[model samples]
Target chain A: MMYIIVLAFYLLFTIWSSVKSLKNTESISDFTTGGHRMGLLLGIGTTTATWVSVASVLGVPGYLYSSGVAAIIGWVAGWCLGGALIPLVAYKIRRPETPVRTFPEFIHLRYEPYKQNSPLRMIVGILMTIGYFLLVHIQVVGFGIVFETITGIDYKIAIFAFLIFLLFTSIGGFWSVAATDTLNTVLIVIGVVLGSGAVLAATGGLQNIVDTLSTTTAPTIAGGPPLEQGILLSPLGTFSLSALISIFISNSLGSPASPHWVTRMLAPKNIKVAILQIMGTIGVLLFIMGPLIILGLGAKALLPSLPAGKTTDYIVPLIIQDYAPPLVGAMTLVALCAAAVSTANSMLLTAGTTLYYDVYLGIFSKKVSDKDFNKRLRLIIFVLGFLAVISAIKPPWFLAMGFVYVYGGFGAAFFLAVFLGLYWKRMNAAGAYAGILIGSVGYVVSKAMGASNPFLIAAGISLIGVILAVYTTKKPPIEAYEPYFEEKVSKSTDRVLSSVINRSEGA
Target chain B: MVTALLIWLGTMIFSFVLGTYLCMRIEKSGVKRWGATGKIFKYK
Candidate 1:
């Protein structure tokens, strides 16, 4: 009953937000970053929503169940380091580039300022779209899977429901999504805290859990792998720490490349990002990592019969079934829906923005005004939402579970290309193009060849692209991009431009 | 009962109070510039 009431109230609140955004939001900045008038709470809320996903919800639980605390440390570390990096990245992103809206726009401004067709950037944009598309698809499928597990609904129906629920999002794209996400994050936190409390209480409290573990009188089975790996929560972990290390590097740099992360730049928080990072760290720790730990503890107690390599990935739902009443169970399901929707919203916006701003404007639609862009953006959102629903009818479990494929393909292609493009002015566009092409092709080839770790294979190919970029052509001299990619990173930030905060979008 | 009592006591006096105090302080001053009705609630 509590869950149902909360969700019903949540729906009403979201409707109110959508109405509010429709009235106020008119231009691109208004749509993209709440017209740059967003306070810190909304900024932190979007950051939390971006940072938490099935990666924490289902991935960490399954990982803990299978491997122990070891596997989780690999993935969660990226988010932790990002807490420190977000300020520096946000500070760099907040200004001068305020006019520069999208991630691809940043690339176009910084590297290809000559404003000519560079095969490399087109490749960069296309490869990233492919990567982000897969990410969007995976989140939609994740919603289907968990909703299926929790509600006993068919997977097809579950996908349709998630898509329909998301159709309630603001028509202005990123603006509506961010506003909705900020409000929704409140419930996500509530569900995590309450769910954790219930599970801990039902399992006879922390003392009882500790006692249960200590009293497991069964002697060790020699030479056999530990039972925790079944849950992906083992002590040392399963995958090579190499996999862990690469994932961290790939994600930290890769995040800034995603248009989703860059859009937050437009919304200037009152606290500047330095403090927001610490708060963001708290948000992820509480909303994401904290729950995984709770779920881990619950799985250790609730599902003792979990077999080798088959830890309870569905730990939270099972606990809800055993612990909470019907309404709470249903509402927590909404929280899961929110997590997946928040993730999908960002990915969909990234792909649509890339298509419209990067590819369409000045080409298909020549006289592109701010008004025209708004119309195109809404059309893209509805079309993308429809495609996601259609594709998620039957999702591959491996991809839906969040590992290996998209991470490897786009992870290798974009991270290396974007970092090189930004930091290395001498980087030839050809090399950047070759890198993305080789990296994406390597992903397909590895899968075709039945390689064990296709992601690593793609990473190797990306490295080959970098080497080619270096050796095949001479680096563009420093003067080539000096006008745009400045040598000294600035410290004097938006405080000088404080007056421009509210007026940036219109004036 | 003893452990629970001690844990509850320590939490109430320390983490809970400190966290609230710090949060309130930040909202009042740290984000006064953002200017949201009266106090900004310091979450930034």
Candidate 2:
């Protein structure tokens, strides 16, 4: 009965927010970038909410429960560093005088300056769609797990419920996503932080948590992998230093390349707001990671054993069900739903926009009317969202691993194209094409060969490819470089001219 | 145990501070100045 009430409340809140957003949204620009007038507060809220997906809230804690502090060092620290780096590039992204609706569109404009109808744009569009689809699939799986845990519904039924809810919420576009994400950020902070406090109070304190985990031993089974004892207390635990460093690098660098995060960068009203958005995200991370760390360790200390075939991901939900107050548990479940929905909506929206703008419009029907295009975009969202739900029906081996794979792939393929292409003057389309092809292929081959640092290896190959391609090929025409370089000269001239005029007026 | 907690907290704090500082520096460093005016193309 309690679960039903909470679920009803959640549904009502979602519908209300969507309706509000839909009233404000009228065109593709509003749908994709929220009219590019988003202020610092909403920018921060949405970015933080989007960044902290189901993976951070549930999967990371579960990882901490099993493998210990290594998860925190590798995932949390790495993500913080990566998010911080966004401001360095955010200004350039938001500075472009022309509005870019999607990340792939930005890539096409930046790299294929001379070419009409660039294939690189289509390639990026497809890659982004696939990457975000995988991301949404994981979120659907998380939704299923949360629903099953809270409402005693079957996982399959829960996934369909998740799909129906997200389809309605996301139909309003970026306005709906930004508004709901901000609300979700608030709930997430309250639920996770208070829930952690409740757990700590129940388990005595931090010292008790340490004592409990220190004495606990991993269960041993015949013909199974050996379990390491006291891994919870050790810094590196069972992970090697190379593996830890690789995880850190992938997360830190890969985050900005995620299409959803790139879209967030594009939505801010100005460059300063974009920078503040990242800063706000960093601040939010500080609050979230501390509580999650406590929750994971506390769960391990409290629930030391599970039935056969169960995983650590179930530990947090189980703890809330068994120990937390009924109201608190329900709220936490709502927050978990919020986390999953915020990310899934953002991913689905990004995939739909990229496919519609970069692929369908760019390649096929350039003359489509605004009304027809909008309808097509809505149709694409439903189709893509449904496809993600279908794909998630059979959950994968590990939700977190899927995240790492997609993130690493995005980083290896697009990191140079974005980072260097924005800053480096000489990087041309050929160089970008070589880098993406080589980097992505190298990443896959290394992963297939079970390389220790596949992302690093792929990144190195991509970098080398860029250097060789740039030097061997003839330089692009000055027109190709005008937007990035000439813009600098023009802006400085304006500043100098304005300062001189102010001095004369003062005299 | 205390040491571990300190490390985790310290790293998170350091990263946040460092990121904020870099963002402000970049804003002031004239990187933002370059992109304010130029030929901007809207994707068709």
Candidate 3:
């Protein structure tokens, strides 16, 4: 009854917010970026809510339950490092007078503003579409797991609940996403804090849980792999030093360059808002991570072995069901749903807009009125969201590691391309193309070969390719490089950029 | 376990401190390129 009431209230609030935002969403700019005038509260809310996806809630806890403290160093510390580096990207990317709406648009402007037909934008658009589809699917899978566990429903039926997010995204676009995300951030904080407090009460305390785990060799789940003594308390845990380092690099170094984060930087009102948003997210995430760690360790002590047919992904729900008060369980489950919805909407909206704004309009030069464009975008978003729901029905195992693969791929492809484009005056379009192609392909090839450090290997190849191409090719045009480096760009350059935006259908 | 907690807390503190310092530098760079205001609710 509590779950039903809480869910009803959440649904009502989301419907109200989405309708309100849809009324104000007048232009493509409002749909894509809230008119490039987002303030601090909305900025931090959206970023933090998006960052704490189902992967962090379910996957990180599962990792800690099975693999121990290594999850903390690998995932938590690595992401924090990435957050620390985001101000650099924000400062430069938001410097232009008229900020670009999407990451691919930024790429187009930085590398080849003159070439409307550049395939670079198309490539980024395609990759982000595919990647975000998988990401949205991951969140759906999470929702399915939680809902099915709580309600005893079939997974397919439970997964369809994700349509709420799709509806929200389609109606109001970025404004709906930001407004709902603020509410989600509050729910997630309260849920996790309540959960950790319960874990402490149930398991005695943190020290007791640690002492018990340090000496236990029992399997984490029935008929599963054995837990080695002292492993759970160790820093490296079961991971080798190489594996730990790779995880760190893939998450920490890869995250700052990821398109979702870069797009977040562009939406804020100015550079100060952008940088402070990221900083504020880091602060809130730290508070959240502490409780997550406590919950994971306490679960190990409270439920030494999960029953057969349940993976470690079941740990969070299992704990709430057995240990938490009824009201607390209801709220925490609602928070999990919020995490999935907040992230799914962001990814779905990004994928849809990138395809619409960058590929169909910018690359192919297909002209449509603003009304027609917005209408088509809604159709595209609906189709993509439905496809993701189908894909999530059989989501792969180990939710956290799935994100590592995607983040690493993004880092390899865009890290050098984005940072160098922002800072280096001589980095030509050819070099940017080479970096993106070689880095993404190298990362895939290395993964296929089962390389221990695929991200590092791919990143190395990308760097060498970028340098070789940059020195061999002619320098970029003055117009292409001036806005990022100079205090004020030339009038001709400004006109060119303004024209480019106009040509790209006011993107 | 204690070591892991310490490392996690330390990294977050470092991030906050470093982020603040960078924000300060960006603020002092120039007012024309970007403004220094951190408005709580304003949006264009």
Candidate 4:
């Protein structure tokens, strides 16, 4: 009863925020990026909320409960390094003069500005659409777990129910997503912090938790073999040193190349706000991760092992149900829901925007009016959300570990291209294409061959591809690279890029 | 145990501070090439 009531109030708040945001969402710019005027507080809120997906909420805790200290090094420290690397991109990407609606559009302008329908843009849009679609599916799978636990509804029905909120929030686009994310960030912090405090109290403290971890021979989850005693406290718990290093590199290096993070960087008002937003988000996320570490380690001491048939994913909800006070449990579960929805809506929006704006408008028809485009974009998001719900009902085995594959692939594909495009004056469309194609293909093949670090290898291949292609191809026109490298672009260059720069000029 | 925890917490703070400083340098330096170019349009 308490869980249902809490969820109901949270749902009501999100719906209210979504409907309210609709008034300000007039153009495609407004729909896609909140008119590129997102302030620092809202920027930090949405970025943090979006960054802390169901993966971070559920998966991170589960990983820690199972694997121990290595999970912290791989995920927490790795992602922090990724956050640190983003400012390099943010400084160039968020120029007030070069406003962009989507990551594909940004790529289009940076590399192939002269072409009407660049294949580079199309390729990026297609990849983003596919990646985000899978991300939405992952979030829905998470929602199924939480909703089923609370409502006793069947998993399929609970997931379908999730689509209603996903559509409602996403239909309002960036403003609605950002607004709800702000509120969700607060909830996540409160829930995690309070839950951590309760877990620490229940386990008697950090010392006890650490001691138990160092001494226990308990299996991480139900029906699993027991780990070697003292392994949990080791630097490389269960994971070999090479595997640990690969996880670290994949998370840190691969994260900066992700389109969603790049899109968030573009939404902020200016370069300073963009840079500060990344810094602020890193700080807040560090705070959140601290409590989660406590919750995961402490839960081990509190519940030495889960019951039969329960996965490590059950650890969090189990801790809430068995150990914490009723109010804290309710709030923490709600926070998990918040994390799922926040990420789902953002991914849905990204996929839809790529399809509607980049693929549809950029390729087949370039003459869409603002009104018609907005309507069509909402429809695309609705359809995509519907598809995600259906897919989650029975996820394919291939999609099980897609988070790592997608992140590493994205890193390999876009790492060199994005960095060089920003700073290298001579990087041409050919180089960009080579980097994306070779990098993505290399990563996929390496993964197929079970390479220790596919991301690192693929990234290396991508660099060589980029270098060869850049040298062989004709240099990019002055107009193409000037806006990114120069604070003051030439008058002619500005005139050439006017159509690309201020996309919402006459809308 | 303490070392791992310290590494985790310490790395996060150091990364943020380093990232911020780099961004400040970029902002402070601005872009130098465009100054020599004639008839340029400055962005805010």
Candidate 5:
């Protein structure tokens, strides 16, 4: 009964949320980016929510419990790359000129400097958007598992609750998700922090946990991973030679190319805030993600007698259900739901907006009157919501925890194309295209063909291909240029988000 | 005890719905002159 009521709370809130987005306008920018007036905080929330996803909470920790610290390092490597490294390598990505409403939007602008056909942009955009939704669908499915497990609710009802609650975000795009994230992030911090403490206490304090694992002697969990990927014994060993080399050159080359992160860069209040997003994101990983790794190890001791190689991804919820007093149990459940909803809402709106604005309005129809565009956008969002629910009913092949494969495939391939290509004039479309193609092919094929560590192989192929293509291409002269990636704007209509970018501010 | 939980839950639902509405209102006002397509309401 309590679970049913909790489900009702989320559903009702989500459904009423989108009533306002019914008549949103019909331009590609309008659909893909909520017309991009996102403030700094909202922008951070959008990037964080989408990046965190259900994979972090459910999949990675359990993998860590069994596989050791290697998995945790593997997951954070991309987040660190995407969040921290992008601002440095892709600093010009934060420049003031372009209406970079999405990653594809950047590709469209940057690639057009060489005047290539839209086919490249379209192919990359469509492939990435599909990959994005696939990631979201896995999360929705995972949430369903949690809901059913806690509430004894039917899977169908659970999915219905998940879809309907998340659908509100689609109506107004980031406005609702951002609003909810303010609340959701606060809830998650409290939940994770307290639950971690309780579980730590429930199992006998932190030192007891330390003694139980004997990881003190076993592995450092702190150091830069070793050549053979062994845990280092000393304090200065965190930056293993392999890790420094791999991270500087080849991080995040195989993950899902998050189209939304780049979109939020243009949405920041100032370039400095764009810099802050890097810090905020890494801070979350260090604080939030770091704690999760510790909690999983704690659970290993608490539930040591249960099983030998079973996925302990279910352990967190099991602990809450069995030990937590009702309110704590309810809040723990809410935190998981909050995380799921934040990601779902962002993905649904992004998919709908991308579908409507980028695919439909840009190519098929032109001059979509504001009224028709908004109506269609709402309709598309509703359809996506239903489709996600339908997709959720069928179990996801990628475990919510196992998204590294897809993230690695898409993130690695796409980030290389966008970041390196945008900054280096020498990087041609052929190089960008080759980077994605080789990386995705290398990673996915390596896995399907039975290779160990498919991720590293995919990234290596992508990096080498892009490097070769760039060097082989003719070098455009190093010269002073425009302050931004200036899109061909219809001077008649001002780009709302682009206008906010103050040129006087760019470094 | 049950009543307190119900009230807390009800308050959250109502506030989120209300808060979302207010935020959307401010957004429309802020983006009004900037050629916001949000105004073109076919659904209305």
Candidate 6:
């Protein structure tokens, strides 16, 4: 009965937030960028919420439970470094003169320079769409797992429920996503922090956890080794140093290149808001990851046995269902669902917007009004969301591996170009194209061949491609690079200041 | 065991502080610069 009430409240809150945001959304810009007037608090809240996806909430903890502190160093430490690096890109990418709604559009404007048509732009756009689609699919899979665990429903039915929920939330665009994401962030913090506290208290505290896990052997799943004593406490417990370093680099460098996160960087009102958003994301991550680590370790100690065929991903849900009070268990379940929905909505929105603006409009449509474009974007959102739900019905793998594939793929393909294109004047269209092509192809070939570090190998090849192409190709003209680097005070700033002052005087 | 716990806690705290400080510095560097207020919202 308590579970039913909590689920009902979740549904009601989602609907209310979507409806309120729908009224505020007017044009494609409003839908895609939230009118570019988001304050620091809302900006930070949404970004953090979006970043803390099902992968972080569920997958990270599970990884910690199974693999020990190595997971923490790879995910938690690496992600903090990644979040901190966002400011370097946020301010420059969100520069007022070349206000781009999507990351692919930025690529076109930056790389193609004088040309109205660039295949490079189209390729990047398509790649971003594909990456985001895979990302949304993972979220849907997570939703199915959580829903099935909590409600005892078939996975297929849970997926349909998830699709319906996200469709309504995404229809209102960035406004709805940001508003609901902020609310979800608050709920997630409460759920994880309280859940951790409950688990710790039940397990008899920190010292007890350390003692219990020290002697306890972790469950063997899918033919993996059992966790021996002292492995969970060591920094590089089971993983090699090279593997840990690779994981850290891939996560830190690849994250900012993600379309959903890039969209968040573009939504804030000003550079200051963007910085605040990054900082807020860091704070939330630290808060969430800290307690989650404790909870995961506690689970490893307390629930050492899993039924046959069950994976570590089942640990958190199992603990909550079996141990916690009905109310707390229901709330935690709701929080996990919220995490999945927030991420899926953002990914779907980014994919839909990229398709509409970059592919449909940039290549096919001659003239599209803002209203019509927004209508098309909404349609694309529904289409993409439905497709994701269908694909998620038969997930490729467990959540962690699925996430790694997409994240690593994106990092290998786009990280070098994004970082160098912004800072290196010598980086030309040839270099950008070559880097993307080589990086993507190398990653695919290496993964197919079962290379141990496909991501790192692909990234190395991409970097070489970038260097060779830059040296061989002709450099872009000064005008092509000016927009990104120039810091001259434009007339627009003067007008904004005058307008603010006039409004104050009139008041 | 105590040392390991202290190391883990210390790393998390350091990350949080360092991240916050870097972001603050980035924001401060942008003050008074053009485009610091970001793009104008033409569409309301």
Error of 4 at A429 (Å): 1.2
Alpha-carbon error at A449 in model 3, in Å? 1.3
User: In candidate 2, which residue ranges exceed 4 Å CA deviation?
Assistant: A220-227, A485-507, B1-44
Q: List lDDT for all candidates, in order.
A: 0.57, 0.76, 0.84, 0.81, 0.56, 0.75
**Model 4 chain A lDDT-worst window of ten:** A395-404
Ordered list by lDDT, greatest first = 3, 4, 2, 6, 1, 5
* Segments of candidate 1 deviating more than 4 angstroms: A1-5, A35-37, A86-88, A95-98, A116-118, A207-233, A238-253, A269-271, A274-284, A305-313, A326-331, A362-365, A398-404, A443-457, A467-507, B1-44
Q: Predicted candidate 2: what Cα RMSD to the true structure?
A: 7.1
Fill in the DockQ of model 3.
0.52
Cα deviation of A361, candidate 4, in Å: 1.5
Between prediction 4 and prediction 6, the one with superior lDDT is: 4
Strongest candidate by DockQ: 3
Error of 1 at A483 (Å): 6.6
For every model in order, the fraction of real contacts preserved is 0.06, 0.25, 0.68, 0.38, 0.00, 0.13
Model 2 chain A lowest lDDT segment of ten: A498-507
RMSD (CA, Å), each prediction: 7.8, 7.1, 2.1, 3.8, 11.4, 5.8
Q: Write the per-residue lDDT of candidate 4 for residues A160-181, one digit (tens) a residue.
A: 9899889889999899999999
lDDT of 1 by residue, A1-507 (tens): 454466567667777776676776677766666656666556668767766676566666655544445544444554454344444334334434333556665555444444444344455566656666777777777777677766677878878877655665636466677788876576667666666677687787766654544433221122344443232333334556565555554444445444555556556653243245344535445555666566655655665544333224565666676786666666666677677777777777777766665666523424445677677777876787778789777664543235445555555565555556545666766666666678778867976797656666776777777777767887654433342344232333222222222222222
DockQ of each: 0.07, 0.19, 0.52, 0.25, 0.02, 0.18
Docking quality of model 6: it rates as incorrect
Model 6 chain A lowest lDDT segment of ten: A498-507
Model 5 DockQ (Cα-based): 0.02
Give candidate 4's error at residue A371 in angstroms. Answer: 1.5
Q: Look at candidate 4 and tell me the lDDT of residue A436.
A: 93
- TM-scores for every predicted model: 0.77, 0.90, 0.96, 0.94, 0.75, 0.90
Candidate 4 DockQ score? 0.25
Compose the digit string of candidate 3's lDDT tens values, residues A356-410.
8888786568767667777888888888888888888787757788888888999
